[model samples]
Target: MTLTVAAVAIGLMVGSVTPLAFAHLAENTPEERLGRTMGNAELGREVGDAGGPLAVGAIAAATSLPVALTALAAAGLASGVLGRVALRDDGRVRPANPPG
Candidate 1:
């Protein structure tokens, strides 16, 4: 029951964030390459989805489940921080150009 609840919570969080992430990507990406950029982003997401479980399983096999889960959580936190830092805007005003 706890695992199910956690899974549902995580799913909700991912569902909420995904559209925002894609919207940000679309906003920052060039119009000509938007499709390709989205495609690549989707591919990367799929790869990560597949790899994350394998990573956790490997770590669990080597150490313990608790340690593995902690490591995964830490890694996720670090990734979020890195992405936030990388995507932060340097204070500069620019005109908005809407895509046709």
Candidate 2:
């Protein structure tokens, strides 16, 4: 049960983090929003491109295939987290709560 919960928890953690980090790629940016939107888009793709393989291989090496797959998924979650970090708001490209 613990392992099962751990698996689910890990899954949920990855599930939540992935989109938070990388949803910007799938966002629709208008012409004016290009500059700001691209920051996240580029970040999402780049991070995914750079990290995906390393994560898979590293996990595979450290553990078994199944664990490695989990790591790969975790990497995806990380990407999502990273992507969302720089996400721009719609309508104005700038967030309503711009940090002071």
Candidate 3:
């Protein structure tokens, strides 16, 4: 019961912050290659969220829930950081803009 309530509150907080966060983040998103950038973001999110189930089902099989949850949270944080770097306009992840 307590966990459910806490999860609900966290969900609500994320929902509320999402739009505000996106408002600033969208501007930082490279408009030129936006399609690819958004695609990476989408893929990152899908993999991160889905990975927990797969990872837990395998490695977390013997681990306690708290430990598993913490590991999942760390994975999520790392993904978020990676997404920011991956979406940047730098040639590292994003290729240089095509010549006109």
Candidate 4:
């Protein structure tokens, strides 16, 4: 029961994060390369979506489930930091237009 709840929570988190990342990519990308960038991004996302659980399972098998989850959390934090740095505003993304 606890594990089920945790799984649901994690699923929610991943669901939100992935779309937000894609939206950020879309908003920041050049119009000419948007399709290609989105395609590549989706491909990478699919790979990660499939591979992430497998990697966590492998880590759990090698060590323990708690340790594997801890490692995943650490990786998430590190990636968040990297993403913030990479996406830092240098005025590259177009400014949002005022809605009429």
Best by TM-score: 4
Top lDDT prediction, candidate number: 4
Pairs of residues clashing in candidate 3: none
Report the lDDT tens digits of candidate 1 across residue range 1-100: 7556655655665576667778999998877889999999899889878998899899989998667666766776687778789888889865565455
Better of 2 and 4 by TM-score: 4
- Cα-based lDDT at residue 96, candidate 2: 36
What global local distance difference test value does model 4 have? 0.79
Query: In the order shown, what is each candidate's alpha-carbon RMSD?
Result: 3.6, 7.2, 5.8, 5.3
Determine the C-alpha RMSD for candidate 2 after optimal superposition of all C-alphas. Answer: 7.2
Candidate lDDT values, in order: 0.77, 0.62, 0.59, 0.79
User: In model 4, which residue pairs have backbone atoms overlapping below 3 Å?
Assistant: none
In angstroms, what RMSD does candidate 4 have relative to the true structure?
Answer: 5.3
- How many backbone collisions does model 4 have? 0
Ranking by lDDT: 4, 1, 2, 3
The C-alpha TM-scores of every prediction are 0.76, 0.42, 0.52, 0.77
The list of candidate 3 runs beyond 4 A from truth reads 1-25, 77-100
User: What lDDT does model 2 reach?
Assistant: 0.62
Model 3 gets an lDDT of 0.59
**Per-residue lDDT over 1-100 for candidate 3, one digit per residue giving the tens place of the 0 to 100 score:** 7546645654564466445445545655557867776667567557745875788566667876556556655654675578568665654553345444
The alpha-carbon deviation from the true structure for residue 52 of candidate 4, after best TM-score superposition, in angstroms, is 0.6
Which runs in model 4 stand beyond 4 Å of their true positions?
A: 1-9, 90-100
